[model samples]
Target: MGIDELREWQAFDSVNPIGNYRTDLNFAVLAQQIARWSGHCTEIPSLKDLLVIDPLPLTNEQRAIETAKADAARSQAYTQSLIATLQSRVKRK
Candidate 1:
């Protein structure tokens, strides 16, 4: 009963507008609802999904920079592990 009533209310509100007809919030909601209705889609893509799109293929220079960053990170991790092992050995002595 609740879901049915909510759907009916949404149907009515879609045409009527929920608040001051020309207000920004009302327009934004109306626009989103219209997009969903027109697209025959129930779920809107999340803001993160919309904004954080897959990056374009990297140029060779960009790929090299990324590779360098990854290599530096691995080297740092290895150094930290070595230092930890040495510290443990020193503590035992």
Candidate 2:
């Protein structure tokens, strides 16, 4: 069941005044099991589906900004790797 349905079930369970019984324990167990299974129930869209859903047509300025950000990230990663390599060489010496 979805999160909403699970919440509804929980609400009903909270107000249920049948006293502490085996059925309550059973329901709790069932709710736990359902919670575990809920992760699998979520629908993750594929790449093709995402493209169709949100065809992000960025403007030239926006594209330029994104490209600059990516370039900065690449440069940062390269600098980090170089630092790591130098540190390893020092350790080996």
Best by TM-score: 2
In model 2, how large is the Cα lDDT of residue 79?
100
Candidate 1 vs. true structure, TM-score = 0.41
lDDT of each residue in 1-93, candidate 2, tens digit only: 999998998898788634455455555556556656778636543443323223377899998999999999999999999999999999999
Q: List the residue pairs that clash in candidate 2.
A: none
Candidate 1 wrong stretches, greater than 4 Å: 1-55
For candidate 2, the per-residue lDDT at 60 reads: 93
TM-score of each: 0.41, 0.43
lDDT of each: 0.72, 0.70
Worst 10 residues of 2 by lDDT: 45-54
Q: Per-residue error at 35 for model 2, in Å?
A: 37
